[model samples]
Target: MDEINSSKQVSVRDFTTNAVQVLDPGQDVMQWTFGGLSRDSGHFRDADLAKILRNVTAAPASAFKACRTPEVLRIIEILSIEQGQKWGVCTLNEFCKFICLKPYATFWDWNEDEEIAAAAKALYHDIDNLELHVGLQAEQAKTLWPGTGLCLGFTISRAILSDAVALTRGDHFLTVDYTHMQLLSILS
Candidate 1:
């Protein structure tokens, strides 16, 4: 884990230098999650992270009526059948009803209407061909060039370590039993 952090510390510096070059060319890059280095640094403030999560949750729900993905629906149906077999009652409806129990059930709580609408528009613009790539490249940039305070720096640094497996596409996700060199197989 320590070694991965050290490597990421180095990679972030390199990535940031490259990002500056790309942005300098007037490219259309989404810098919203760049930890505010590109714009209002207050957006990346600690209080904002929680608000961001809340907004994300509400935006999807308001824009899509429901967050029912096919995979999630299937999981709910299977769980319903299993629970019905044991309790002789359809727990599926109860589970579905419980969706409102979430904190973002009301969109007003997050003030996310505009953000969600904007995100939906952006997503649909490129929806014809979905990109399989993860957003780790941007995440890497955030960890490297975060414009937040020392507290955020330490938080993002630790996050970089925790998500090292995801960021590097390592063979194993984060396992204390493994050495850093073995995990670098993904990089190779």
Candidate 2:
């Protein structure tokens, strides 16, 4: 575990400077595009991703390794693609249309999250009228990115780290995109 921990502390580029060829010829380069794109985007800094992986594994309750590997990188690439696709369709117009089909509260469930309800009430001061609360929530939802998929980041993070294994070579980072004020996860 100590050796594993030490590797994560090292600069990612130090290791990556020596590129390891993918052993499998049929390993579908297209699937690896997200990984390459993420690396090229400058958004997912390798060192940063290494740090995040370290942080996650450092948690006392964590059941994951801090090592990065090709398999891990592949998983991260897929996750990035999923996030990009979700964001591509996460337009305000789409949110408005979605709200019309279903009340925003159904997905958000203000009552379920006391903080959400309190914040809504604080802004509107109309807890008595359900319609007003719903409307206020809808407006708030519009201001959020991925208006429909609010908890996507948490979900994806859990999925990515659920397996109890050490990190390996191609492993990358998954991060929350807070700019949209929505719970979105993206490949870093």
Candidate 3:
């Protein structure tokens, strides 16, 4: 906050130079990310803030080796999962069935990683017990086909597409020009 208030506007060239200097993979790119830079004594540096911005926007997508999320965050995540379950959120298998896809028989079906599957099994006990949102985040991004650009979780992608079609079909505003008959064919 201090940095934002005190900083002067910088030219595009200066911004680009700073970004290039930090984004060099040979350097410790991970140190510039949100979790790494100092927040000690309840303060942070302007250069650290700038580095974080570059890391978020310009860093390579494949650079992440691990989540590196703090242990405290895992406790918060557990609370979130409990709250979602309490609110009657469906399990991942249920959601898959609802979407006309086959329900996953095991955690292995959800993801190939043995460690992730083991963790899910320890927490949820079975595939049917896995929470929807947790599975959405944990599942590997499916390569739908050649040339399909976006790398998204399979269930998340399906849910978004389902919601989009439902919105188009149910909303009177979106159907103003296209006939409901034609909309069916197009959305279908």
Top-TM-score candidate index: 3
Q: Score candidate 1 by lDDT.
A: 0.37
Weakest 10 consecutive residues of candidate 1 by summed lDDT: 131-140
Q: Give per-residue CA lDDT, model 2, range 1-188, as digits (tens).
A: 22434543444443344334443456765445433335454356677678777987785442211121334344343444456556654432233344443333332343435565566567546433333213322333212355553322222233335433325323433223333334333333
Error of 1 at 90 (Å): 5.9
TM-score of each: 0.18, 0.20, 0.53
Per-residue lDDT for 1-188 in model 3, tens only?
Answer: 22323223443455456667768778754455446667545567778888878987784444111132344244445557778978999988888999998889998888878888898899899899998878877776665578976667777788889999999888876677578777888898
Estimate every model's Cα lDDT from 0 to 1.
0.37, 0.40, 0.71
Worst 10 residues of 3 by lDDT: 63-72
State, as a TM-score between 0 and 1, how close model 1 is to the true structure.
0.18
Question: lDDT by residue for model 1 over 92-131, one digit each (tens)?
Answer: 2232233332222222221234554345336433321111
Off by over 4 Å in 2: 1-52, 60-96, 99-101, 105-108, 124-188
- By TM-score, rank the candidates, best first: 3, 2, 1
Off by over 4 Å in 1: 1-49, 61-70, 90-188
Q: For this target, which candidate reaches the highest lDDT against the unseen true structure?
A: 3
